[model samples]
Target: MKAKYRRRFGFKATKNGPALQSTIVKACASVVIPALNEAKRIQEVVAYALADPATDEVIVIDDSSIDNTAMLARQAGALVVTSSMLGKGTSMRDGAAAAIQDIVVYLDGDLANLRPGIITSLCLPLLNNEADFVKARFGRGGGRVTELTAKPMLKVFFPELAHLAQPLGGIIAARRSLLQALTFEDGYGVDVGLLVDAYLAGAQLAEVDIGSLEHDSQPLHDLTFMANEVSRVIFNRAKLAGRLHVEQVIAMYESQRQVTAGIDYVLSLRKGRRCLLLLDMDGTITPSRFALELARITGNEAALMQMLDTPHDDAITRSERIAGLFRFVHKQQFEQTARSLEIRPGVVELVNQARRAGFMVGVVSDSYFIAAEIIRRRIFADFALAHTLTFEGDVCNGQLQINSAFLPDDDDADAPICKSNVLRCVLADKTPPPVELIWAVGDNLNDLEMLRLADNAFVIDPKSPKLSEEPGIAVINAFTDLVKLLGHEANLVDQK
Candidate 1:
């Protein structure tokens, strides 16, 4: 990127030059990278961020990649967040929303070329308070869409931004506070949208030269789509600024919803494990639903059937209501029911095989941990995560306690402590799980979250048509499919 294109730049409310450098507290940046199937090089990108002294945290938002991206990034020492298949904009917003640092920098995951000081160069301006938003201008980058669509549209609609070297560049840094305040365009337009939004919001923006770099070129078809999206964003922002008002707007995207993941809680899980394998308890570990079985055993069958037949409530409320039916049910009775529930075939063999192969096998459930533990012992799983059933004396008090591990940062529905959130928070050992994989098995939608986090995910006897709606999740009738997903991890026992 040469200085020939309008050497020094300012947009909207940004001053001609930054006069307020070096007055704030020390800067600690969070590097947020939105990745899809870039499993080939995500580790190096994450490592670069972690190695930088300026980076306080490295977060890779895995966009439902079928590869080992999430597990690998975590093993490489980054806090990994498993996002839905929404797109880059959603990933960016989620990453920044979860950032602990004041400064947030986003880098592309597939970059094969990177200079050592890239992060420092991007953060220096913001660190010293020289600017509120910083965009990276790197040399030797070939951005076909930027040259054709992004720049031309910028020239027509946002001429002040037309001079930017790489308007579509994903490498950008901004004040996390301001980034949160702006609405993000949740598609390929996120980068440019942020640029315009910052300018419109009166941010002091700077374009720093990061020197030579290379990026993987997209296929022609993908490029065509990207160009259209980029053009649309520029046009949309222009209309929002009241530049173009021809009747109504076209292709207006809803503002992105920011999420606050329990990153600290995730980082606090059991460490020093290599691989993590989570099996859903109710249907996978035990053939029958524990609640239904308990209802039958305790003579609360009629009440339990009524509760199940009634319209379902929110998970929290439904859990409470169900526990109310079990009021005065003794712990021993709960354990006895769990113990009596028949185990799925090949269950014991699978756990032993995985554990011997250096994997951490655990039982995952939406039911109470007390019952989950009873199943865990039968299967010999290393751990379990489930809603806690509070007891008064020997009987359930009809109150449930969701562990801090399963608790959400807010009341947001998507933020619930699903299997995905728990996985995002665990298997964070810096060196990694013994195996480089994370395998999860569940019978229903409850395990859908882990499908986003695990390198390999399997659905056992899928209970809903909605489960089939999820792409890439292999549905299996038994542990046979799980072993196949395990894909030849040898069963090697640890020799002390």
Candidate 2:
């Protein structure tokens, strides 16, 4: 289905027109600010944009601010556009219309610690033809949730965007050619919507550190609204990109929300009992495509497997080989392909059952965090350990950076994460005491360590190519058979 709202301000195409084309050969650069009640900081924001020589024009769209934001922006030599519609999206649209330049830079007006260099840092990539889009990152900001939540969420579900550091940040720069083609959501979701849309439209993107900036931290009370808006933006983009099926979208939403709500409730209960449920990504929750898919997209799949599959006695050499494979696949294509993967049947039911059984579910995988996050969101797993991707703007640096907590130390013997390490961590974190019953599941050789660590382990749909063949691990063809194995009632599963 087509998006309900369309871009009205930018270049419009006529019916049966011979493709829309740009009028300007060289796109001028404009800085667009969507301001609300930023009377104190609007002028500083305008000044920063104007100070950059590359920025030809500054357009500030006031979203019905009761404060003197428009007046302040005008005083700073910016062209002011007032919008009665009252939203960041509407303001952006108005600003885009007033812009004479083909390259637009959007900045939040409430930054108290705004730096002049940020303007140049954000716009330079787009101006020099290095990237089609740029996202700004600050040293001191309330973007921890964004880094931990949104970015990882995008990486897993929208792998094409796995490289974007601040997907929901208020600051961005994009070429008019790409900006005009996007449908912006008119709420808290606008930033994320733009990022996903631009990436899906095949724009080369990157993020740059603007040093540091301080802003009002969102209170814990606002998380629900943020999550809803973020989810809406992600789901809509996924639907548009054909990564998400319409019917399954509803189920996906329900399953995710339920898992999150369940976790919240479980944490609140303060139960002393602690149980751990370790999950595998590739084939257990979703279909395994990392090897073949990476090969097909990057043309380096064989080389990647050789590095991973070969008997590497040297840890450093093994790490280098894996990193080399990631370097070959462009972040955008990797994400797009990952999103197209399908989840296993009855996976949600199994997760809900596990949650009800008082198991503290978490994922331990050698895969990228973005890939692990997809499983986490799909099943509402509490935590995940995976590889990290370094991003400058929207594009990746092609470096495979692992999370420090998951990294192996010099003294550690059994590779970085022997399933025993994951088990020990979970067991140690239990509030009262670790539960006697612990269950782990997997389908690959990577899971062998964890499976051995668990009190009981289930190997689901194992491929013949895998190396390990542990005797204690019960083989299950389908996840639906889990309830019977665990002696649970089928009706107890939370379908919602």
Candidate 3:
């Protein structure tokens, strides 16, 4: 009966039964290429792969490429596997399985600028046990996503990987031990997914410069899709590692609340006592909710939320994240849409009233000076402390040149214009030493530390639900409520 079934199915029966066996042959190294319509570039890439002395074999998986990619790769001395399904992730998995070497190197087919050195650079770290995985970095041709998405995400969630630049670069090499243990996602996010997986798997990773290599640039419409996939990979890895706990999530939310409440209390007391009031534009007076709105408009809401969920530690530089934010804004042209943003109601009136009360009212927001200047002039603010954006003629240079004076030095001083430091400066320059009271209000996690240092805290309409749990924090639904709480007539004109 078994023989008859085998004959009917066109299967050859062997003496060792038909069960799948663990094929674990080990060679020096194997190069795997997941090619899709790369007939013209496959040969050159294969030649580059073969040039490395450590490379014992090359495997190319053609995922139903419309071109003669498989034929070309086979002709170039590579073992080709034809995959019925498409996707770089699936092709990579197929190629990895076919690799007979202890070390596996994966390279993209479109690397027209391919050189022999890249293979060595990718494989050396893995071969020497210095790293279980190696990522490639090109001097001139790296993707903007590396600087904007991967680096910032790493800086926030996994600070150890922050120093490993180009965390999302496609070219990588790893030991077979590590490759077999990972779960590769099928999409443009495969590279980032792999890095996060490796990190969570306790594999040491390093980045190596592979010289300059050119590839196609993705369109703006593709960014949201790419960001979503990348975020999925990151969140999945974090979840698998038990890093995203409910308690920690709650704490982050509460911190945001405490800070917001603290800011409100300080501002309210100052308004009552006729003291000068200064507020930071971003995350202070005006909420950072505009970014969320922009993300919603651009269809990147999921990606933005994922980023907001990541736990940021001190190791991550705020400057780098700020740079990423600027890039994100420029890419979406969100600044042009600022006129439509909704401010916390009564903020303008609060500024005006404070000024009328003999207070030097102004803003100290981290928003671009140009944008803040518009708000400053409109509200008749006395001064604005903001970063000046660098521009070439009329166009933006996409780089933020923060004034050096704002950066904190090593003399037991914090950032020169940080919320607490700014408040201190205002007190020293304008008010008597040991002023009656210092009040501050805000609405995000970033404001928590500064709020804790203040005499009173007030939480406003908060984005995070955790704020409700903060001890001794006064919560208000509207800015007018704050005015009433401060023993002043409600400013109904600015009410939303």
Candidate 4:
């Protein structure tokens, strides 16, 4: 359950200090996990990525895995993509190409005991605009091949990079732009190749401490093959850099000859509607937050403000507390306010078109299901998922029932009532055909998880400008853009 590799790290950058912009502009990242047949460990690895606040997107690049690596990753809320070829380097390159964030991180699938802040630590330098590329230095010492082969070779050939603690470490983060401009080797040489390319690209690189990254070490034969491949690439790069002579090239080829066999490049969720589109009712479908509207109209705005000012006791407790504020509100007034809220333009058409395109369109809200259902029918969605409010004698009874769909599942039992959990409940149904694409739209912090879980996400006028830096999330000002996006995506679905 824990990684054995551990090592200390010291950052050399003197230019930028700690990330003060973290409060306003998050250190958003797109995590690219190059996995191959790593079924047992892939799900946990993806979960580590998903749990990070900085990780807006978790992309699992399946390099023709034989096991359920891809399926488990998808089930764990990662965006899975099949590699064009069966190589870690190809997966890395393709993952970078697919990433839409400013920072792209590559994580080996087999790594274990990954700290929750791993991505944030790897990305902080880049977020503060200090480093162009980052390599993770774990607590454990170097692997056999790293010590016997990579380090010695780097010392001889690329002396400038000889100081790197983990030249062969697979945990790396770099600006997407930098990754886009670089090339990825298609074998065991990929990690070293990236280091050399980044150095050659004149990227300001930094290494940070990611404590206790442990994994099963490669066997002697596998280590031999890895050392051969790694040395081969380093020599090739040295030759390209004109740092090697005829004798060194001959020595490299000699080593290749010494190694008789080549290495195989390796390393390496859900049922429901064939496709699902979840729209957040408050700001997503109604263009305005229903809670704020209700508070203002009922003259209980201060009570609602108090709700925000108070620390949440627990999700259920918070829901009950907020529902208590509506005790003075009558059912008729609630219905009137829910019905009076204007639906955003193009929602009906988007929902309808999405359904026709094989998507089960629904509205998932943190607010009451009654209001959500009202909005859902207004847009003609298939269903609505939200908390339920009780009534007694035509007035709210100050008791709230959380939607089962919003409650935690077996994976995260103690977490808050998140829309993403509702999505999981829907996708977990075995009755529906396999889901093709999950499209989601939302507007605020509450909706962040839902958007992240969705394959295609649209954030309506995001409050935090940082959302724009996240991958697989689009910030839209108007509703018409969503209509167009759905139509285009629908065409792709139809073509498929």
Candidate 5:
């Protein structure tokens, strides 16, 4: 998807470029390039920044480069400063501190092919006061780590940021005041973490089309380390914002480490044609039941139980009423609690096994998007579908937006949100691979339609005694049993 700017306070563009240029002169920008052993490309990048009319100064943070990167930057007309051999985050902090201009523009030193006028373009939004922070989006497609790790997590937790084509892009410009107040995450996450912090702090954020950017891609093995640090920063921010507790952050970090380590193992295995692997997020994927933490935190277990028992006539109504219970609960509290839940022991193994066996593993849940996507990344699901909750900064505003993909077909106002429709739509779209059979797994009444629609369905809800004897539904005590089921099916397909 193309990156769209998320402007607050209804900013409108004026046809007064001359006037805006005047403002740029007043608010001088210092272009800061953080470098590490970029002797070949630093000179050109530095020259481009220096030539921009809006820029009053240029600073390069040489991160303990053993080469002549610092000397080259100085020769190219930039103030060079040395940073400790720590990480990019440290360089960013040090560079910002050394800047004397009102705005700071951060550009990667290794950009081999940078378009002219890109620096001036990135500074316009800040000069006119339309944005306090601006991220540059270029024409090149983002990397695999972006598509695989960063995008999914952003879609789930920070939906407002989903439109950004390159959330991890190092080309960004922000007000010096905002930059000073923000925390810089070390390594690969510095870019994404800055964007998230800016958005959550209610800063006017914009992304400019900076034409095309060309830079060298990292080696395959190094990408795993990059993904780990990036994922850690994403979760670490949530913890600092009170969206996740300390234990939850540690658990998430450890799980992602396993994900990185197992990347080679999963890719080396031969994958097959498409089959279906549908999963539910709340209790089926995790240990505890749904919304149990919310009730416990607010001391409203009785209220929660009443809402569950007192069914509203329609899905919208039911969702709206349930959301009302969280109005008093801060979004941070809700998110932190959700992150604290641990996944089932064999869940990740099952997902990896399914993928290696040519199954299209997807999470289809009636739960909110944040929880669904977070769990999806932990287990490495291909895609996910879930409802979105609205939030202002760090607080939920008691409003819920149901996913239009799963909305009921008819005009029955009282009808519930049906996952069966979404499942059918997904199956229809998988035409090339042609899904031979579907396997649905869930733990509650909300999954009834989906379970019935699947070729094979399993009820893993230990608490639901009523579903134990349901016809055509298999009841399983442990998720590890799916390995046997898949193995048996593989034999049948082989015979065919």
Candidate 6:
């Protein structure tokens, strides 16, 4: 993308006398840019900020960008500082701390159509004593998030500031004193929070037009998280002001509960050799539910319910109790029951498609290894990880041995023996793939953590009520839908 970069020279005092100039200033100003994986556009932005003679320094806060953003920014004559993976708010504050100037101007790094003199326009109001903090208003106005979320919340909580346009614009300039006096929000709420706090603190605020500005919009999956954080900060501030009743607060939480969160399908042309595809065996790959099948076959449906209903401290104890109920059933009978369960439609096709797409498919389940392995062999999966059931002379024993691989490490003892731990073991190989390249498919309560851990997950069973309601997970009605989903992803990669 081409951007306009205007070159301007420093102001020179005439021989006659010093004249009042509003276009240029002699005071020092620090332009701070918070960047993450913005290597393509950071250089242009850094050069633009340094072109102004009033700018004494340019600082780019690298927020743990995986790309070469820091190196490129330094090449463009900007001081680079590394920061934690907290978010943009932390980056901005860290950059401010490293600055030496009293006046600070913040600009985004990923603008495709940024015009000339944006920094000057934002800082001029603050320099002329017309405003304590100035926010930029550019062409093509507010985004969908600002219009749908921030504006309505502002109208209710901050009516006096409702008339302003693009309240969440990141381009801003403020005095050191005013900037230090405000608290920064953690995520997407930072921009709007600063504006609200500044107005409430009795500081003069101004909005300046900086012409047309364009940048990338976040994917739909990320917008859900943004909306949650933005809503949280706004409501917390409202409650602190004593503007909400106790019942109202409870209702608000109930209304906007974040049940599920899905990952963005990032499009990339780079192909890797291996991808860990974790599939849940019980309700996911098979049509019949595991526990229900066991209960029906053993004629102990009431006993199974009693064991399940009894409260336990952790997953290990719960699994032990559930396994103890099947002491009398023979190993052969259990295997027969497992094989009788019908495989979900499109099971083989999806697995084959993933293999052709360069994925190492495996089964990570909470069921017994005997049954999981049987299904794995039938479908020709690469690997299987599950609990081991003990048997002597073809007779099933009451004792159940939990898979050591599923156990949590010493650092986190309380963590459940969930599929995520199995995933961790898979990733501990000599050449493990990054989390972004991993994909998961599962259905049930135990699969929740694993679904959240993978880059993108598919909940392939419609009967799973708990998993279906969760946000961020892509809940599909049938296993056939996965073929289409993966095909779409492949097409996107091909286009890129």
Candidate 6 segments exceeding 4 Å error: 1-23, 245-496
Which regions of candidate 5 deviate over 4 angstroms?
Answer: 1-27, 242-496
Model 3 lDDT on a 0 to 1 scale? 0.60
lDDT, each prediction = 0.72, 0.65, 0.60, 0.75, 0.73, 0.71
Give me the displacement of residue 166 in model 3, in angstroms.
1.7
Per-model RMSD to reference = 20.7, 17.1, 22.2, 24.4, 12.1, 18.1
Candidate 4 on 1-496: residue-level lDDT in tens?
A: 1111111112122333322222333538999999999998998788777665567788999988889999999987789999999899999999999998989998999987655567878888898889999999874346657765776677667778877879999999999999888878988999999999999999998999876666766776888889889988988898899988765544434332211111100000111336778888876788777878888998888988877776747656776887888886887788788899988788888888777766777778888866877887788887667777755555677777766666677677778777788667555543324456788888877888888888898888676766777788988877677766666776666566
Worst 10 residues of 1 by lDDT: 251-260
* Better structure of 3 and 6 per lDDT: 6
Per-residue lDDT tens digits for candidate 1, residues 1-496, read 1111112221112222221221221337899999998889988788766655466778899999999988888887889998755789989999989999889999999986565556767888887789999999875332556654665566656668767887888999999999999877877888999999999999998999877666676877997888788777888889889877442222111000000111222232334456778888888788899999999988988987777666656777777788888889888999899989999888898888777666777787888878887788889887777777655455677887665556554646567666676675564333223335678888777778777678777787788987777877777777854565443643322331
Q: Mind sharing the TM-score for model 4?
A: 0.46
lDDT of 3 by residue, 89-174 (tens): 87887778888887889988877755434565666677677998988876422344554455545555566777775677778898
lDDT of 1 at 215: 62
Per-prediction backbone clash count = 8, 12, 14, 12, 1, 7
Q: Which ten residues in a row have the lowest lDDT in candidate 3?
A: 17-26
Worst 10 residues of 6 by lDDT: 258-267
- What lDDT does candidate 1 reach at residue 277? 84
Q: Residue 241: error of model 1 in Å? A: 0.7
**Candidate 3 stretches greater than 4 Å from native:** 1-27, 140-142, 245-496
Please give, for residues 1-496, the per-residue lDDT of candidate 6 as tens digits: 0122233322234432111232346546899999999999999788878765557789999998999999999988899998655689888888777888878999899976565556666777787899998889874336556655665566666667767778888998988788788888779999888887888788999998876676777888988888777777777777766665565544343222111000000011112435557788887899776666877888978987776787654667877877888887887788887788888888878888877766667777787877776787777676667776665545667777777667777799977676787667555532212333577888777788888888778787645687777787888777677776675554444444
| TM-score head-to-head 1 vs 3, winner | 3
Query: For model 6, which pairs clash?
Result: 259-471, 260-470, 260-471, 260-472, 261-471, 261-472, 262-472
The TM-scores, one per candidate, come to: 0.45, 0.48, 0.48, 0.46, 0.48, 0.47
